[model samples]
Target: MTKAAAVLDYRAQARRRLPPFLFEYLDGGSYAEVTLRRNVAVLEQLALRQRVLTDVSAIDLTTTLFGAAQSLPVMLAPIGLAGMNARRGEVQAIRAANAAGIPFCLSTVSVCPLAEVAAAATAPFWFQLYMIRDRGLVRALLDEARQLGCSALVFTVDMPVPGARYRDYRSGLAGASGLGGTLRRFGQAMTHPEWALDVGVRGRPHHLGNVAPALGDKTGLEDFLGWMRTNFDSSVTWRDLDFIRSHWQGPLIIKGILDPADAREAARTGADGIVVSNHGGRQLDGVPATADALPAIVDAVGDALTVLADGGVRSGLDVVKLMALGAKGVLLGRAWAYALAANGEAGVAHVLRLIEAEMRVAMALCGRTRIADIDRSMLVSTAFQRQDSL
Candidate 1:
C-alpha cells in the first residue's frame, strides 16, 4: 500500500500486515470497550481555539521529560509482546524513537530482553514494570535495568488483576485454547506469510525475555499468559511502593492512575510522575476516559509530580489535546505498535514525523508556539467543563 500519511492510516495497514490474532491484540480493548470509545470521543469534543495573526512562524515541539530532551512532547508507551509485531520489533521501535529524539519505554513482558534493547540504543530509554508476586524476580529485573542504562522506571499499578479482554479470548490470546486453538492460529499464520516469515521465522525464540528464566520448560505464549495470571500481585498495596523505591534509583513514574485521590497518594509515595490512564481502556471497561479523569488529577497533583496521560491518542492533535488537558506528555500505545507491524523501524519513524508535523500546524493555528504555552487556554472552554456541570 501507499505510505501511511497519518497515525490511523498505519492502523489500517497493520491490520492487513499482521495476523488476525496479533492485530486483534493490538486493536481490541477490554469487555464491551465503552471506555475505549469514550477516550477518543471525549478528546474529540475539546476543540482547539485558533487565531489568525499572531506570529505563527516558528513552532517548537521540543520538551524535557524525566530529565531527557524530546523532539516532541510524546513518548512510545510500553507494549507487551510488541516485539512480535515485527522482527525484533521493540528494538526497531526504540531505534526509531531514539532517532526521532523521544524516549521508548520497554515493557516487562516484551519479546526482546532489556539487554537486547540496550544494545541497540544510542540514547537511554525508560523501562516499565509490573508488580509480580515474585519480589525476588522483580528485584532482579530492577538490577538488570540499572546495569542496562535505563533512564526511568514506569511502575504500572493499574493491573493488579488482568482484565477480561474479550478480544484476547476470542483471538486465543488468553485462556486455555487447547489443540483446536493452536491449529487455528497456525492456519492464520500460514495465511499471513509476511508476518510468519519476519516475526515467526526470523524473530527466533519468541519467549517473553524478561521472565523466561522463571518459565523453566513452559516457554510457549500460553505459558506466558499462565505466568502472568498467577504471578500478578493482587495483594499489592501502597506499602509495595516503598519496596520498589528502595531498589530503583531513577525517575519513578506511577502509571495507570485515574482518580485525584490516587494521584495524591502517588505523589505522597514520592513518585516522580504519574500517568492518568485507564490502561488504554484495556483494563476496566467502565472507568472514565483518561481525558475526563485528567483535569481533577492534575489539579490535585500537577505540581507534586509530572502528570502524563494516554488513551485513544491517534494523532498530533490528540497529543496537543492531552497537553491542553494538563498532561506533561502523551504516551503512544497502539499507534506505534501499528506502525511497527505495518512496516518496521521506518514506519514508526515516519509516523512520529507525522505527529510532530501535525503538532506544529496545530500549535501554530492555536497561537501556541512552544510546548509550555499549550494549556487549557489553547483549548476552547469546553475542556473546562466537568461532566456533572454539563
Candidate 2:
C-alpha cells in the first residue's frame, strides 16, 4: 500500500480497498444527505485567526476527558461493523488508539465482541450503546461493559430508528445472501481480493458480538438487521436514562444532542458529557451541522457537563476548530474508519500521527499553546462573535 498523506487520500484508498456495499455503508448519510453536505460546508466556512511572533515552541495537546488524561482532545468515535473493514478491525483500531494515547469507543454492533476487544486492548476502551427495546438486554450489555472495565458509556440518543440511507438499498447492502440483488455486491467484493481474504475469509465472528447472545438462533447479517429494526425502541424518553443510570455507574455521555434545550435536558439526567452531533448527518437530513449547533449547546450546558462535537471532522485543523467553537473535545467517525479500511491498523496509526502533526501546526499558527487556550477569539466569523456572547 502507498503512503496516505491526508484523510482524502485514505478515503480514496478505502474506496479502492473495500467493496462498494461496505464502503457506501460506511460513507453514505440519510435521505437527501443535505445535512451531511452541510456538516463539512459549515466547518469549511469558519476562518481561523492566525498569529505569529509569539512563542509557540512548547505546544501542548494534552487534555482530560471524563476524568482521564489523553494526549489529544479527540476520541475514535464508535463505528459499527468495524471488524468487517479488516480482520478484527475494532481490535486493530483500539490498539492504534491506545498507542496514540487516545480513547477508542467500541460500538454495540461491532463485529469483535466487547470481551475480545477488552482482552486484546492494553487500555480500557469506551463503550457506545444504542438503546434497544428489551430493558433486560440493555442491562446485560451495561453489565458486560462494566465487567470489561469500560470507563465511559456513550448512549447514542439520535437513532431510535435507523435512517433511510439510499446508498445501502442501492448497493444491495441490505439484501439477503444468495439473492439476485446481491450479485452486484459479490462482483464488487471480487474486485477487492485483499478485503475478501482479510475481512471476508479471515474475519470470523462476523456477527454483531454484543447483541449475539440475545439474538439466539438468528445470527446472520440479515437477521441482525431485522432484529435491530425491531428492537430499537422508538419510544425511548428521558425516563430511559434512569434505567441506564441504575445499571451503569460510570461516566455516561449523551451522544446525539444538537439543541440547547436537549443539551440542558441531558445535563439534567446527570450525564457527565454531551456530544453535539447530528448522528453524522445520518438520522435527519435537514438538521443543523454539528459545528452550527455546538456553540449554543455548549453555552447552554458547558458549565453543567463536558461538551464534545462530531461531524465532518477530517483533519487536526478541524479538531482545533471544534475546540475554538467551545467543544472540550471532538469525536471522529469516518476519518478513522477510512484509515482502517485503507490500510488496517497501520493506516489508522498513520492518520492519527498526521492529525497530531496538523493540530500542532494549527495551534502554533493560531497562537494557542494548549488545547484549553483555544476559544472563539481564535475564530473570525460574525456568527461566531454572536455565539461568543452566548
Candidate 3:
C-alpha cells in the first residue's frame, strides 16, 4: 500500500477496534472541538516548497535535547488513562517509543504506576507531574519518579480545572461519577470487550497510580475524581515551580506554555526546556495552535532553553512544519493514542514508522536533506477563510 493509504488503513482499523467512547476520548477535544480542528487546520494551511536538486541521500534525523540524543524529533506526549484505549497502554506505547529511539512521557494520571511503567520500559522515560494540593504527596511522587530514574520532570502548568469535553459528557463519562462509578465505568467497559479483558479483567484501573497511595485504598472512580478535583492545586505559580525545581536537580521541563511571555517566564524560572502547547487544545476552546505560537516562544528564550511543540501534530509533515517554525522537537498525543486503540504495540510502531517515513519524504521534497535543514522558508500560508471552508 502507498504511505498515505497505509495511514488511512490504520485509521480505519483503529475505528473498528476501539469502541465509540474510547475513540471519542482519543479523538475529541474541548467544547465544540473548535480549537482542536483549528489547530490542525492552521498547520495544514502552510505550504512547503519542493526543491529540484540536492544531495538528499545521507539524511540525518538524529537530534539532541536535555543532553540526550534521539533518533527522531518526535516524542510521545503524556496521555491520561491510556489503558482505556488498550491493555497496558502506557507500557505498550513506551515499548514502541523505545524501539523507535524516542522518549515517552508518562502522565500523572496514567493507569499504570510510575514504577510499573519504569520497570517495563527498557529506556529511561520522562515523567509528567501534575502538582497536587498535598505537598507531601507531591514530594513523595516526585521522589518516586526520581528514584525510578526518570530522565526529566515535565510539570504541566495549565489544567487547573478540567475542560468541559463535550464528547466525554455526551458519552456519559462525566455523569458516571458516584460510589458505583467504578461499576458504571465497568458497564461502559462492557462495550469494549477487548479493552475489558485486556486491561480491566486482567488488571485494575483506579486513581492516578502515583497518587493513589494518598487516597487510602479507594477504588471508586468518583472518589478518585473527587480527590483529584479537590487536590489539583489551582493556585500553582512560578513560585511553586521553583519549589519543585529546588527538589529535583535534573532537567526540569515546563509543559503547557503557549504564550511567548509565558515561555519567557519558563526560561526565567530555571526550566531546562519548555513545551509549546495548548494542552492539545483540550484545556481551552479558542487558543491558537502550538505551531503558530512556537516561533515567538523560541525567540523569547534567546536559545537559553530547549523549545518543544505539541498540539495537533498528526503526521511527519506536521513534525517538519513545527521544526521549520523553530520547534526543536514535536510531541504526539492523540495520534499515538489512536494507534494504541487500534493495534496495541504493533499499531504504535506502525505510526512511528509512518511518520518517520513521511518526515523523510517531506524533507527530501523540500530540498532539506536532513531534519535539521527544514526551515520557515519551506512554507507558505494559503490565504483562505478556514471556517467557511470547513
In candidate 1, what are the lDDT values of residues 315-337, reduced to their tens digit? 78889999998999999998888
Ranking by TM-score: 1, 2, 3
Residue runs of model 2 more than 4 Å from their true location after superposition: 1-5, 175-178, 181-184, 382-390
Give the TM-score comparing model 3 with the true structure, all chains together.
0.93
Between candidates 2 and 3, the one scoring higher on lDDT is: 2
Q: lDDT for every model?
A: 0.88, 0.88, 0.81
Error of 1 at 234 (Å): 0.5
lDDT of 2 by residue, 304-351 (tens): 999989998887888888989999989999999998998889989988
Clashing residue pairs in candidate 2 (N, C-alpha, C atoms within 3 angstroms): none
| Model 1, residue pairs in steric clash | none
Q: Write the per-residue lDDT of candidate 3 for residues 93-128, one digit (tens) a residue.
A: 999999999999999888889988988888899999
Clashing pairs in model 3? none
Worst 10 residues of 3 by lDDT: 381-390
Error of 2 at 29 (Å): 0.4
Q: What are the TM-scores, per candidate, against the unseen true structure?
A: 0.96, 0.95, 0.93
Measured on C-alpha atoms, candidate 2 has an lDDT of 0.88
